[model samples]
Target: MNRQQKGWQQLFLFSLLPLFLAIFGASGWLWWNWAISPAQLNAAKPQQIQIPPGTATQQIGTKLEQAGLIRSKIAWDLLARYISSQKSNGGFQAGTYELSANQPLNEIAQTIWDGKVIQVSFTIPEGWSLRQMADYFQKEKGWFSSQDFIDAASQIDRKKYPWLPADIPFLEGFLFPETYQVTKERITPQAVVQLMLERFEKTALPVYQKSQNQELNQPKFTLKQWVTLASIVEKEAVVQKERPRIAGVFVSRLLKGMKLESDPTVEYAFGIRQTPDKPLTFAQVRKPSPYNTYATPGLPPTPIAAPALESLKAVLNPESTEYLFFVARYDGTHVFSRTLPEHEAAVVKIRRERQR
Candidate 1:
């Protein structure tokens, strides 16, 4: 070949090389911008999207893009691929997620991948005493001290809760029994108490007002007193259907000036329980204390436990009956009687069956 022709060919190749390099560099910059930049460049508000269970990573990217939470589906797909390559089992989780438009593609991918869901749950069972509720959190969750919870619940500002009674003696009957949720990291003893109290205010206030309008409360006793009675009934009634009946028996005894004779009140007054599910001793029953119904003429000064909705309603509208006494049967139910002789006979029958 001629020298002039070879020189021209070399110049042409060199010129093409710079053009290819410039094109490659521009492409690299664009890719980098897509990878690191927020999906919605000017988006300042947050958005919510639910990534359903078993959703593939590609679908998640598509959903995010469609929801305006992510900029590019290709970028998100690549980011998820990179994350999956780094971990043994890495993928988005199934949950309702709060994502912001300003969140970068990589950050969004990492959040769904880690499954940093935000809820912490705790349950207070029906008929759990304040102490029992405290003990439950301490023993099961290991979250806080029992006494701390008690103090926090009692000392919260009553003014903040207009529905809560001003003269409410303690937080015993007011901490409603229900499942509560809070931010996982923000779950504290005080937070739990506040949550429970708020739940009580929201749920119990209407019931309290209804009972008052119906004159369901005992004639001489105030709302708090009725609540106290309901608390006692709560601990005594093992079966759900028996709450109103048990409340009736107590009401009858109270009207006739008879001692309540409730074993749970004695246990609460003396703070003696061999086991959570055991019967009380004769000596424990006879112990003299203000809280002990056998020693006191009226309801205890304060509620002994957290009464559920059923217990509260039972006190407001007790079953009308002539029964004045009751004894526990083998099936964790009570056998009611109108007279001492009938009660004794029922007790004997229960004892014989238990012995058998």
Candidate 2:
């Protein structure tokens, strides 16, 4: 044990210490990287998913993880935070946005926030019948229809829709018209009707209930009656703002024991319940059917179609007018008259306008 040898031995030991530390540190780093890596980049590589509006951050993170976009949820949050911290108003907009695996957390956040969504806007006009709606849906390659729209729309168990009458032939006025998102694999005629019914229930039912609450001794009409009337108004009225007035006119006529004489009722049976393009003639009005308002004195067996909130509101609260008979004035407006003479005059005026 010479002093020089002892010094050399100590130096060797000290040199070995750094090597051991390096090996241990490297192993630990490798383990961490292997065990705690972020989302599987490969998993998300195959598809670009649209993140839906109102998706929870955790759900989005899980989706990313499942989709193999990122290695970890923490990374997503970190990225979101980094983006949020930037001098920007907000991080993202709510929509169906596309994403895929291997996409950086920063890009994901920006895309989601930027709301580069793949959404198809489905527009259902306010006055379109369920048959028309169904036909429109059938034509869209985006959606699949299992049955004819008219048949689908007409198929209803009055027991299920007790809001409907027992003798009703077709349920027409129950379908609400408005723009809808129509989610993928989630769209169906039944679903469409259910959504419309739910929306209608939200807005129309309250009014019907209020009306029910007011009367005693008078045979209470179920919500179905109101829906039927609303459907009539929706089809009969040329304009939205005129829906309630149209409903009021029907109500007035009904109270007076008069036939609805509604063209839609004629259309529903003889003219065009399923077909949008059909001419209505006096012969069709004279044809006998439960849906023919010209033939049947009371409400048809069921709602003719789904009605919007405006029509529903009109049914629940009608305008105070002496008029009952109404005809299209050929100017997208209607001519209303109380008596037969007035109605005849209005009809002549409409005919003249049509000829012009």
TM-score, every prediction: 0.68, 0.64
N/CA/C clash count, model 2: 25
CA lDDT, every prediction? Answer: 0.80, 0.68
In candidate 2 the C-alpha lDDT for residue 92 amounts to 60
lDDT of 1 at 55: 92
lDDT tens per residue, model 2, 153-173 = 566755565565565555566
True-structure lDDT of candidate 1: 0.80
Q: Over the stretch 238-318, how does candidate 1's per-residue lDDT look in tens digits?
A: 899999999999988989989898878888888776442466776777778889987778788888888888898888788
lDDT of 1 at 147: 88
Pairs with backbone N, CA or C atoms under 3 Å apart (clashes), candidate 1:
39-71
